[model samples]
Target: MLHSIRAIVNGSTNFILTKMFDENLGFKEALLLAQQLGFAESNPTLDVEGFDALNKWTIFLCHAYGIVTTPDQILFTGIQNIHKSDALVAKARGQQIRLVAQAKKLVDGGVAAFVLPQFVLADNPLSFVKNEYNGVVIESGFADQQFFYGKGAGSFPTASAVLSDLSALRYGYKYEYKKLYHHEPNQLNDDIYLRVYVSFTDVKNIPTEDFEWIEQWHAQEDRKYLSGVIALKKLKTTIWWKENGTSLILEPDPIIENIEVRKLKKKAWNWLDYCRINLI
Candidate 1:
């Protein structure tokens, strides 16, 4: 069975975010340019707020794994809450922030999905894709992994996709989606562990108890962030996570088992076979 599909299905917001990182443009400034260039609509609520990615994710689900789901049927997070500080933290660690829509086949044959912004490490292939380009990484038992990339938005980009469908008529093409009908039902759960970064304003209000083992936390008069591993479902139920002026990024788990960071500033750890500060 297919394991997972992680996609960046929205282009407009991606373009806007890419500009913010590459050019140091503010959110509104990048958004205006995205609109002027036709990458984004005048009202980009769907794109910026992740509804567009949710819709696209459902479509991909129907075709890839043959599961029917709607935007409201799943949990989703948008990119509007992202800050320049968030991107700076990622960049300082040689990473970039990207909006990701992910659908996974659970171990119990159940399905789960969500859309959120992620801090992608420089070594990840997804990190290379920027601007209006869209990428999908398909993980499966048989094939192991496969990645596909293309333009996911724009009039010409959309037109070309339609043209491909029209051209397929000569070869008789159709989506098989053989696994659509199944016993599994789509659901959300906290069984999955995630390494997350949470930013807060009030120094005294941060929920230190919510995290199982906090690896590192930064607090200042203006800037603050917490890094640790926690269950997604549990984090969602917290008021601190649901409140405004808060942001979260799920980081990849380290390769080393029971890894401990003693002095991150003095010594280097081979978490991804490179020099990286181990937050846990």
Candidate 2:
């Protein structure tokens, strides 16, 4: 019955992004404010680099789908590369940028998981989760979609969560970990495809050949942006995006199934064959 779980699990990054969106602040300025307010650590590598969200998502999978895995096993991208330009562009398109952690169960008993900065459309509930708030959406076959939202940071929320746990103990409550105990035939799968928006300072470094199909491209004197479909495995194997001034964010409804990718490839091949016969 479990289908997918998507959430913004890191409050610090969310706060930084919200400031960027609402006040037109740069990423660094917003991060500094979060640190000053005790919302982020002095050394915020874990949060800004997405390791924190990856940790939370790793645990979420274990509880939700009985799939146990480490952070290193999943492909994750942070908000470090984001800039004011990216935020402004998203706003122009009626979308917001959020650090999204997501996992979906495939029909083949596999689970696809990733943590990345993604474009959330205006109507998506996650677009409304701003500052230090967290929101989770769980989709299932029968229950449809359920959303859980709450304050996700600061001293009070931490204390509140602890107090709630203490109260549960008083009632002799315990975590059933039903999924883990029952066990499901699920393993991590990355042989998927995604539509992504990439912004880069250098065209050569962007690797245009890697994309399966490019839908949009914009080149400017200062920067370049492109949107295209690409194999998820290519992202997992490449580190080019992490170098220098480049940012990659998943396009809205980014996930593409394997069967769809194959179909597209087949169509491309058929078109190529027709062109070859006509030329001859």
Candidate 3:
């Protein structure tokens, strides 16, 4: 049998809502059920990685533009790799990290969607959005830009948004959601700080040739300690070994090319594990 409901009403949308059904059920499971019921999709990537913000943005685009598109066509990035050290530095510098999902209408009658992590200065409105809160900014030629902010995730929050959409649909509002091919890839440009640990067989023979661009702040050869920051452009290659214990912090060069940041993240994670640093 096939069944459809306008929408479900709820109070809170926190993880607790999923827990009420099954102790082991999670947000992904609940979303999967909704997808199977034709209410959503099995977008494990977004639900697990927080790119669901982009999914919500895609729905909004369809409503505003009278067309259809999927979040897959948009640029996406998640904060799953952001380390505690980076967060600490951001806090020290009076900054906060935010998951920003955006959609823009191009001047030439095109649309764009993107989901990425951003470091917002303390003064930005985005910085004020705390955990699980969602905010959107809309722009149009006829009307001034509009901003909407509210509880973005959780079962109750999503239910509210769905109910609102259902109401519009019942009033004869018709919208088409479509999937489009996104040919344009997103290029990430940002400053990243990485903490690393290193060890060398012969401390005296350690080559500084590969790290000429790295700024050495302090070193203690007796304890085999080397901590510094290197510009991403200066990194020619990285070699790792279990025996060579090392610790260092690096900043991405302003113009880094030919390397995926994910590789750097893996290296950092390994170093952290070796150093027995608590990544969490």
Candidate 4:
């Protein structure tokens, strides 16, 4: 890995090759190589979950705070569990879901590491990132705040970042170093969007009162489906319920579990069907 890092730093060198013998050729290979080559001194977990953003955050912590922390000490989350329903819900609320990984220095000489889904507000810098784009923000007393935005992952991007590190190392840039201290977890609160679908036949048996509730929460029309419009509300209520093979759609008043979200979708479908029949 050091050789690879060195090659990247050289800049003049092109076509660096890395070979992995492991059966799972995913991020484990990269993580292992990084550790073996001293780029990282300990095992990292998020590397396997495709959350390399956390790894990058650690590197930033090292540079900014002069601290070295184990991967386990960082709180990591992944987007593997995000469902289509969630995305749809976000769209209904005039928002989008982003996989955000962040680290920050606390007041007590510690750092915070975490990764999860975030609903970027229109004015937030991260809201501009689309597709696979990535962004980073750093704040400190001297620098006030700094922002780094670019491709967070991909072979070429990784290579570029490695190359930059190599150039700095080769130039004999002296960096101030500080030991890592255990820090409290970051208190994260971000909205999420979910998209749900229900069979047309299963949306006719829910109660009228439930349908009224859904109508009140309705936000906008959805272009993807003909039967339903996009709806928005807080993520805290049980807006959907299922009954007698019918499903209903409704918006939650506050944040709820994904399972509850599923159940709500089922109920919403049922409610829609009931309205269709009564109108007919």
Candidate 5:
């Protein structure tokens, strides 16, 4: 009903991640099976790395807001770099690591959109969607939450969509663009602050001054979790942890407050499951 929509527009990566998390399969194994089962292409460069989703996002924008853009114009990240350790970390916290592609209207009359990897809490309906399925959430004034979940991959599915398009043509029907003027997509961290879980092998390489505050952290010899709230703009430019094999997931909410590093242990559950108040 609303002009704005948020959707997970990919199927191969969804299926692979589903297999990796729900079925407990490795990335390689899940990818191989996806290709074998016709869920993925022989050369799955687009699907696995998120280019496919980027394309779908571009299409969505064209129809939803009458804005047309290219893949290079948007912020995009894929699931190719997701490691088993990352999945295990999310699983330990009762979360699902999902490669979510999101597009929505911002409060400032601009659009905030991106396709990237994010951690979904167990309570979210998106976490329950698995395999070659897609979950799309449309939020607006009249319709607060509209979720569309179904099989979104395979040759049959693709053909069915193609046929539907053809059938619409027979009826002299076409998608109408509600918006033709385009504005620059808002960069992350501009006006919105997100709670991110950043993991790295070494803490020395992290930039401590960029975040407004460090809520909590978990330190391990080879793995660490730095939980903090930061602007989306600052986060893109301050990815120093990647050189040290760092991975990040945006939290759904900011729960923890100012936490001291001394209280962090080598292994602890989420910020909620661990000690909220630092005793030391």
Candidate 6:
């Protein structure tokens, strides 16, 4: 649909995450299983590294909103860093991890897109999208929410898609590109903020000072987890998140409002104030 807000289009990463979440398999183990089952490739860099989803998101951008963008132009992260511990924590919290490629039309007529592993709440439809199934949830202002799901990978789906394309061509079908020709495409915006979860072996690897807000945190003997709000721009520009065995994932419904950002910043400041006074 023309007003589609978000689309999760990749199945390889989804299958891996599904295995990790449902079967408690580690990343590499799940990946190997996927490769064995034809869900993934011998070289899974494109799928597990988020490039495949990034490319698919760009195509969705062009088709849905007439916005032309490349994978390099957007911020993306993959499931490679996900560990069994992360999956355990998520399962304990009744959430599932999924690689989601989503874009939203902002109030300022700009668009923001990301391909990243996200925590899906139990009630979210994405939580049920397991194995090699792909699911897309499109939120439209006028039509409410619509969801589509199907096999997104493997030889059968690929062959079916090719045959469908041939059939469409034989029937003289064509994409109107109405959004591109008749409507003004929105520009990609990186000025927004997202609530994120980061698990790391060392706090030094995390840029805590850059956080607009931190809602929760925990430290165990082996690992530490922090939940915070950060600028999308910072994520795009910084390399800290990719280093030293750090894993970052977005919370379910990661986007937050500017007013909420300000309020959380104030709360974080108050928390620091209490910490400074030893009032805990």
Best by TM-score: 6
| Model 1 lDDT tens row, 1-280 | 6788887888887898799899888788888998888899889998988888888888787776667766766656777777788878887888888888887776654566667788887877678778999988888999998888988778899789899999888789876665565534345433554667877777466677666556677876386898876655665566566466688776753211122323331243334334244542
Candidate 1: lDDT over CA atoms? 0.73
Score candidate 5 by TM-score against the native. Answer: 0.77
For candidate 6, the TM-score is 0.93
lDDT of 2: 0.90
Q: What is the C-alpha local distance difference test score of candidate 5?
A: 0.72
- Model 6 per-residue lDDT at 48: 93
Q: lDDT per model, in order?
A: 0.73, 0.90, 0.42, 0.39, 0.72, 0.85
Each model's TM-score, in the order given?
0.78, 0.91, 0.43, 0.42, 0.77, 0.93
Sort the predicted structures by lDDT, highest score first. 2, 6, 1, 5, 3, 4
The number of clashing residue pairs in each candidate reads 0, 0, 16, 33, 5, 0
Question: Which parts of model 4 have CA positions greater than 4 angstroms off?
Answer: 1-50, 104-110, 139-146, 154-156, 165-175, 178-280
For model 5, how does the per-residue alpha-carbon lDDT over 1-280 read when each residue is reduced to its tens digit? 3435656678889999988887788889999999999999999998987898988888787666666677766666677767677788888888988878776655554566667788888877788778898998787788688789988899999999999999999999977665554533333213445567777776777787777557777785466778876666665565463455566666754222223222332233345445566532
lDDT comparison, 3 vs 6, better candidate: 6
- Between candidates 1 and 5, name the one with more favorable TM-score: 1
In candidate 6, what are the lDDT values of residues 1-280, reduced to their tens digit?
3344555578888889889888888889999999999999999999898988898888788878888888889999888899888999898998988888898877655788888888889988878888899999888877788788999989999889999999999999997776688888778877789999999998978879998878889986488899989999889899788788789999988986565677777888988899989966
- Judge candidate 2 at residue 116 and give its lDDT: 98
Query: Evaluated with lDDT, which candidate comes out highest?
Result: 2
Clashes of 2: 0
Model 1 misplacement above 4 A: 161-176, 182-190, 204-206, 236-239, 254-280
Clashes of 5: 5
Regions more than 4 Å wrong, model 3: 1-45, 61-69, 103-112, 138-146, 166-171, 175-280
